[model samples]
Target: MTNKDVYIAKMKMQLDELDGQMSVLEARAKEAKDDARAKYEEEMAKLHEQSKLAQGKLDSMKSATAEAWDATVAEMEKVRDAFVHSFSYFKSQL
Candidate 1:
């Protein structure tokens, strides 16, 4: 496959992994005690937001026009960095 195809595949895989992680977080949040559940729910919300943003970025990357690929890639990189930063912050809080 072409490099773009491979990249897209990788992005899709990462998005799938994030979705699974969010599912686990949601389940954990639902099962926790009152105070801890609140905290877990808050963290899960933040992660869900980040995951949504990442998915948006991936979707944009996948659908970008040929002439716009460079700019789209740059924006996707920024989105990825933001997602990673948010994930780290969320992990630190837990």
Candidate 2:
């Protein structure tokens, strides 16, 4: 497969893994006390927003032409990295 194809596949897999982690985090958040749960939910809301943005970027990147492919990859990586970093920090807090 081409590099773009490989990159797209990898990103999709990573996003799927993140989604799974989010599910686990959501379950943990549900088990928290009311006050803590509120905090977790707030973070989760931010995460969901970021996730949506990342997914939108990914979708667009998939259709990008060769000329735009590199730029699209860079943008997608930025969003994905932010999401991953946020998820890691939130998970550490729990």
Candidate 3:
């Protein structure tokens, strides 16, 4: 397979993994206590938003070449960082 094909495959796999993680997080958030439930929901919402944004970015790169994969990777990294920051802050509060 070509490099672009490989990149697309990898991107789709990453997105699937993120979707699975989001689902698990959502379940955990729903199971949280009354006081902590709000914070958990907020964090889960942030993650869901980031995941949507990341999926959009990945979709936009459908016609991209191997060289353009870098941009997609960078966008995914930003999303990951945001998720980490939000998760960490919420964790610290609880």
Which candidate's lDDT is highest? Answer: 2
**TM-scores for candidates 1 onward, in order:** 0.76, 0.96, 0.72
lDDT on C-alpha atoms for all candidate structures: 0.76, 0.94, 0.71
In angstroms, how far off is 92's CA in candidate 2?
0.6
Which predicted model would earn the best TM-score? 2
- Give the alpha carbon lDDT tens digit for every residue of 1-94 in model 1: 9777788888778768767766765775687789888888877777778778888888888778889988987877787777777766655555
State in Å the error of residue 62, model 1: 2.0
Q: What is the alpha-carbon lDDT of model 1 when measured against the actual structure?
A: 0.76
> Higher-TM-score candidate among 1 and 3?
1
- Please give the ranking of all candidate structures by TM-score, highest first, separated by commas: 2, 1, 3
Global Cα lDDT for candidate 3: 0.71
- In angstroms, the error of model 3 at 44 is 0.8
For residue 58, model 3's alpha carbon misses the true position, in angstroms, by 0.5
Q: Which regions of candidate 2 are displaced past 4 Å?
A: none
lDDT score at residue 87, model 2, on the 0-100 scale: 98
- Tens digits of lDDT, candidate 2, 1-94: 9898899999999998998899999999999999999999999999999899988998998899999988999999999999999999999989
